[model samples]
Target: MLDIAKTAQLTPDLLRSFLVAADTGSFTRTASLVHKTQAAVSMQMKKLEEDLQCLLFKRDGRGVSLTAEGEILYRYSAKILELHDEALTAVSGPKLHGKVRLGAPDDYAMKHLPGILREFSVNHPQVQVDVFCDDTPNLSKMLDNGQLDLVIATDNVKTKFSAPLELTWILPERMDPSGLKELPLALFHPVCCYRENGLKALEKASRKYRIAYGSPSLAGLLAAVQGGLAIAVVTKDTTAKGCRHALPSDGLPPIKSVYIDLRFKPRNRSEVVSVLGGFIAKGLGIVI
Candidate 1:
């Protein structure tokens, strides 16, 4: 006879935390991603390990990495969560049926939007998510003009829904910026946060730099950077394969942190719009 009382059951919360930890390879980062304290995340992982009666993580100086058992669990955890969400939607209520006009910068649309949209579609299969890619200033204008139901913008002072984003200096793998007296840069237009912040940082640091290439498109700027025409300041997520970060030893000025802001019209906002907005914010771990 089996002792059912002694068996440990896996819960969605624990699996979610574990999945984040595995993906990030850091409990601290996982804590931030899941909106929990580091200690709380640690406790959850400990409980999960105890429940499974197996070691799932190997801790080292850099961070934690998954063990063999952890790898196995990660695969199943993702499927389980997917099915979990699917099951809830199937029984919860009538599926939401509407259209959500979403706008984002091209960079974010490529780097971050896909997974979030995929999850959203799973929950609300009938809802149509229309994505428009443009610069932040243009996206904000569209949102204000009621051309878009929701938008993700680079944060400014008045932003209410925001999340932290890290910026990095991206340079071609074979090129070094330190050797040049006047640093060459591939930058966006004046309205862009990357352009404004990067130039400001270089000026404040008394570094001489010139706009070697300028474009309104992320693809064009990345091409310039990848071709070693110039370095660029961009969000950490969008660094290309042939590029590397400008390290402290590279003698480049540090870029400041920025925020991803979510915007929506306050008046006459439909329930579906609000739902999509909340979903995006939550997906990005933005605090309302």
Candidate 2:
């Protein structure tokens, strides 16, 4: 048991080497990052696999790549390192004291993110937040341009990381099913994930539909829905009051909400990125 604990303690350093190696695709680069020799890094990785009883990396003429176990370990190691940094930040106050420009879809900003932003602000009062509410593509562009430090947008453009949400179609309470065939759809602008899914499902099912209304803002969309203009697809948590779900009748596909973050280079890279990433994970209910 004592030996097991000792081995477990070494696992993090092993993971560190593995992550660096995978990123650089070279044990030499990993060795430089860890201040160790290439042989030392290789030995640590070998001991890691021995301790876990699993192969974590595959090496060949094409260069080294992560095995299945290595991919899993890398994902968890990133999270572990994130939490470890968060702990250090909590103990070492004011590490991230600067303006943080964040972007989110209007719906998330209006409905799902207030409590999260409030909590984040309370925890780090020294950090000032400026928020932009926009469509996913616009936010992605802003993130790419470094105009935004962090963004919370529906997954449309591919990014290195994303968090998932469960999406559902919502309608006015006690709405009649007889009008299902001629259902009016509420939608955002083109390129929105929810709108795309909703339209695809309708088309796939051959359900006759028309756009009764559209809005880039959640408040406008909900207001339109409340007034019996149309039904809309949105995340389960983001649904407003006075609305009920409109489940697919037969062959329509279900939709999933994926929240993707753009990787931005930060001025205070470690501290700012750490807090922003942690806040995002906690907001999305991802277990750190």
Candidate 3:
């Protein structure tokens, strides 16, 4: 049996060193970052290997690469560091005092996010929130530029890192598709998940459809649909408020909603992001 006491005694500093080594692909560079001698870094790594009884790295031509065990340990180390950072920030701050610029796509912003934000605001009364309603691609760009701290957007473009949610189709109420060959549709602008999914579904089924109306805002799309223009596809949670599902009858395709986060920058504001993200996840019943 493994020594429970020894496992419990593993330190965060050692984990941090392990991650730094994995990231830089060199014990020397990792030692420089951690202000330790190269020999000391190598010793720590050897000690870690002994404790775990696994080879964490293998020396290549001139550098080192992670073994399979090393790769797994790196992933866990990153999560540990992330959680540690969040905990430190939560206790270090005066209730997140800052203007947190947040952005969301119009559909979700209107339908689902309000309740989550409401609960967040009640909990952190000191935070000043500035929200922008826009398309997913634009919102993602803003997040990359640090113009916004958090964003809730549909999965249109692929990010190196992201959290995804499943999406569904919504159609007109009590509509029959007995003789329908094509669908008259309302869609959001480009790079929106609903728009992409709708188009893909039609193409995959070889169905012909026309853009009856296109809108940048959810309100505009809903207005056009309600005015007897066409049907729109949206997240299940967003559409459950008013619209009904239309698939299997019209042969429309099904889609999923994906939530993505820009992890390019490691900021001191991650705790706030995590708290708000948790609210969103719980509200949507998905872990993105």
The candidate that achieves the highest TM-score relative to the unseen native structure: 1
Q: Candidate 3, residues 1-288: lDDT per residue as tens digits?
A: 998456644576788778767866677656645657789989889989888888999986436889999999898887886676566557765466556677877766655555466456546656677888887678868888889887765565555445565566566565554356667888887767678877887788677788888889888877766566578876543432234666676556665455544332457357766666666656554444
| Model 1 spans > 4 angstroms off | 1-94, 156-158
TM match of model 3 to true structure: 0.58
What tens-digit string does per-residue lDDT give for candidate 2 at 145-208?
Answer: 8788777767644455565666777777767645566878788878788888778877886788
CA lDDT for candidate 2: 0.70
- Error of model 3, residue 9, in angstroms: 49
True lDDT of residue 224, candidate 1:
92
Relative to the true structure, how large is the alpha-carbon lDDT of every model? Answer: 0.82, 0.70, 0.68
Local accuracy of candidate 1 as per-residue lDDT tens digits, 1-288:
544347767788888889878876777666655668889999999988877788999986547899999999999999998898778877885568999899998877765675477557766878988999988889988988889999888853546688788888999888877888998899998899888889989999999988989898888899998797899988865646567878888999888878888888789479888887777888777877
Any runs in candidate 3 off by more than 4 Å, and if so which? 1-94, 156-164, 240-242, 256-264, 268-274, 285-288
Clashes of 2: 0
Candidate 2: regions farther than 4 A off? 1-95, 156-159, 247-253, 256-263, 266-270, 286-288
Give per-model TM-scores.
0.70, 0.61, 0.58
Per-residue lDDT value at 94 in model 3: 46
Top-lDDT candidate index? 1
Model 1 error, position 285 (Å)? 2.0
